[model samples]
Target: MKTLTLAATAILLTAGFASAQTVRIGTEGAYPPYNMINDAGEVDGYERELGDELCKRAELDCTWVKNDWDSIIPNLVSGNYDAIMAGMAINEERQKVIQFTQNYVPPQASAYAAMSADADVEGGVVAAQTGTIQASHVAETGATLVEFATPDETLAAVRNGEADAVFADKEYLVPHVEESNGELVWIGEDIALDEGIGVGLRQSDTELKDKFDAAIASMKEDGSLNEMIGKWFGEGAPLFE
Candidate 1:
């Protein structure tokens, strides 16, 4: 819904840093284990905790901004925020418009959820959040894709039989399926979408990006990053090693 250019992005980043301003990090507060609005109506989740640590390590003054997922990248490009840490996987398509720091979270699986175990996610009507890798994957496959503005809407479509299944990140869908008490179940094996999750920044903010990248690299080297990933995603969660 929003668009951005490299020149505009660079100018914004340069001006903000000149005065030692707070670097605003953008996230979709609706995706859990990554980002969500807590009971206090503030951003919380793995990204929140990880972002705070990353900022602390980089010694940068930073803040968080919640934005709609579809507009997250456009807003970042348009200078609504200085970075993105909303469980975004690093991929070639996204790399074309914006730059990314090294990945923080390892590549995770995507899966399908439905009321029936045999639901045809491969060919039947499937729902996915708009502007996500799942939506793009569904569109490219034989399944008829139904796009929703949010993840909850996609699950609701499946629960109500409006869709055969909902395709999304396995991490996000895991709790929902477990809570369904047999009402919903995984329909297929895991689907791998991108390389890993990373911080999204404007191409011009090379200096800022380097700071976060170095922090992320340090965490990886010390195993603190994997510990954080396991803590949030469960002990069985994937690790760099």
Candidate 2:
């Protein structure tokens, strides 16, 4: 919500980037591969690396700020941060509130994990993080949707038998399944949801959005964006053409 003064606007127009002030980039520090608090207590992961590169390319003085996923948008709208790079999907519902840079991550499937491969994915109780596309989808599907405040809680619901399955981003669920030692398995076919993940910006901050959009485009064209995606999501993840 920071507005540039006329002199600052002139400088920004000449610079061709949102450089009038430090752009605060908000992210959920709990989502791994997308973003997480590392051993050093600093934000780390794919979005962190991508955000740094975008800032470098855009010539924007930027800083990373951690926010809970459920309130991330509201805080941004309230000017708690200037942009969001928290693996948020670009969809019609979100478009009504905020602007988005072109997707840095491509459309990917969501998967259901449960204790048994035969677990009922349709009619059984399923857990999903609150305010997520997966949560809304599970509510719409035949499954009895159980909501949790955090991604870990959704998985815990499956682990503790509170829910039959936990539905989430396939990449987000892979590490848990692999490390589950046979306790968790993919229960059903993957479900595609949302358009893709992008950097969310305030609707009024079109200049900031344009700066990030151009930086994302440059990375996409140079293949560095795909490289970072693979580094985090694994080589099997889909990449842009």
Candidate 3:
């Protein structure tokens, strides 16, 4: 039975190896300024735009797949995808589960204070996404955390007073506030998460990981990365700076 099991594992491994060249990218098509699904059901946003740019630089044929935000990292680890490009912030906790490319995009955090006292959020109070830097700080500061799946929900939570404040990437939330009818302020202070956004891969796939790093370096040197960032994020954005 052990012999049989080993043989089956070998066959599966061989198949995985054979098809590894074409990198599969996973994302949540609902996180705007990172990844979002358009009305046409196509993924678009800064991360999506960056993914295409990386593929071009690496000369790799890439295929992008959209999944829920909560499932992206799990799917990548399960081999459902070769990498993750969901505007994910690379922190030490996540590093235990997967490897990440060099910081392609610097990390930026934004905080939004509530404009009302009657807003309704889960648990009727808190700030920032759970497990995020803001949440950690709130926890330490003895404040409650009202977690949400998307920035829209987070911002809405603040507007309605369900949350005392909301925190996330400025690039993601600033545009949202600008377009909203509410009066959310930047607070002029950001919580630096000490993380950078990067492509995620299996911890053992050094070769593939190196390719992504090389591609990113090339893109930066050739100004393609800057151009892509400017195109997606606009000039003088804090995330880009």
Best candidate per TM-score, number? 2
How close is every model to the real structure, measured as TM-score? 0.90, 0.92, 0.81
* 27-141: candidate 2 lDDT, tens digit per residue: 9988888899999999999999999988877788889999999999999999999999998988888999998988999888899999999899899999999889999999998
Between candidates 1 and 2, name the one with more favorable lDDT: 2
lDDT for model 1: 0.86
lDDT winner among the candidates? 2
lDDT, residue 50, model 3? 83
Which prediction has more favorable lDDT, 1 or 3?
Answer: 1
Residue-by-residue lDDT tens digits, candidate 1, 83-151: 998888888999999999888888889999899988998789999999888899999999999999999
Runs with alpha carbons beyond 4 Å of true place in candidate 1: 1-21
Q: All candidates' lDDT scores?
A: 0.86, 0.87, 0.69
Q: Which residue pairs collide, candidate 3?
A: 119-160, 119-161, 119-162, 126-144
